[model samples]
Target: MADLKGKSRATTTPADGCALCSLPLLVPQEPSSDIEDDEDEETPSHLIDDVELPCGDHFHWDCLMNASKISPVDKLRFCLFCRQQAVTIADDGSEKLLVHVRNEGGLTSNFDLGEEIRSEIAFDSNPHLRRTEAFLSLMSQDDLETAEEMLRGEDGAEPVDPNSTYEEGGLTALHVAAYNNNVRAIELLLRYGAQKDKRSNDGASPLDCASQVEAWNAVQVLNS
Candidate 1:
């Protein structure tokens, strides 16, 4: 990430401001004198190419790319605010935030993040999605006891149906659990009436979802 040591010169900032430097979305007024230019140095306009992630937050391209580099894993990088896969539109309307990966052979290639980690990127407006997300979170954390209680409508709260679909994708609790490789959570949901063969709106079964993310443990459990 470019060292944002100087204050932003712009008077107005985007409401969805850049998360990394916390400065105005505009390019830095001038490149830091300390930064030596190289053959690959990007122009100011290119450097300031801001992007809005799937989570609805904006960030500078360089800053987001720098943050993504921290993850050594080969999987798609997610937004810091929400753990959903990070995707955005380029100025030309093409998919931005392509993940460039290097293999053991030292070859590099870019790939678009077409994978969907969470159907609901931001659930602030939808109470149903928020509640369902909470249940999914508990499942990911392996808090089976609380998850069961929520399913049973304990404490006067409306019971969360284990098989109920959520958000635009119509993903069931089992789909989420399987995608996250939470074997224990899968077993818990199955015990509480979650359908093992339930499919998402995209027609992906729990096993298919698990395999998409290479969640081997979840795949084994679902296959059995």
Candidate 2:
């Protein structure tokens, strides 16, 4: 995945004005020499990504993502819809605000975020996904001891429903254990007869699911 590191794009600071809404941006005639390259590096919150807009304004990748949740895709891109810029404002403010170009605005979301940031990746067939959900609920309601006790109950009985799928969304108990990131839970699930090589609807092996999920810790525990 591409990384944004010494990636330099002369960060321009617009003139002082209302940054939160579409207020006229006032840029100083000349930029000071002492400005750092990444002056835009700081944000009030974590920014997901930078997206280029038809309005010639760039919005945070997630700002567009959240906007997508509310607006239709056709409204996402103004140029495509033959409308004026969907939203616009100043990009040089302390914060880049998404404002109405007043016509259409579409949002683009790069879903590869988690995989991009992770040092490792894995896939695990998550059969019995509800089992994982149930475990989480139980874990939240009871102490770790109690959660483990329930898992270990029925004398090494782990769930046998392969339909509890994950990944391709088909998961077994062993897959759930690895998804839970619990080393002992994995061991208990395996001891209770959860198959190691079970394939999911997407033909993902348990190891495959572990890799994609990046449960490296669980991967090591289960493989060993």
**Which number leads on TM-score?**
1
Across 165-214, the per-residue lDDT of candidate 1 in tens digits comes to: 76669888789888889888888888888888788898999999999999
Please list the residue runs of candidate 2 whose C-alpha ends up more than 4 Å from where it truly belongs after superposition: 1-10, 14-20, 23-51, 60-63, 77-185, 188-197, 201-224
lDDT string for model 2 (90-154, tens) is 44632122332211112222223223212122212243444555555454343445445546654
Taking all chains together, the TM-score of candidate 2 against the true structure is 0.32
Summing lDDT over every window of 10 consecutive residues in candidate 2, give the lowest-scoring window.
100-109
Which sections of candidate 1 miss by over 4 Å?
Answer: 1-133, 140-142
- True-vs-predicted CA distance for residue 40, candidate 1, Å: 46
CA lDDT of every candidate: 0.64, 0.46
Cα RMSD (angstroms) for every candidate in the order listed: 15.1, 14.1
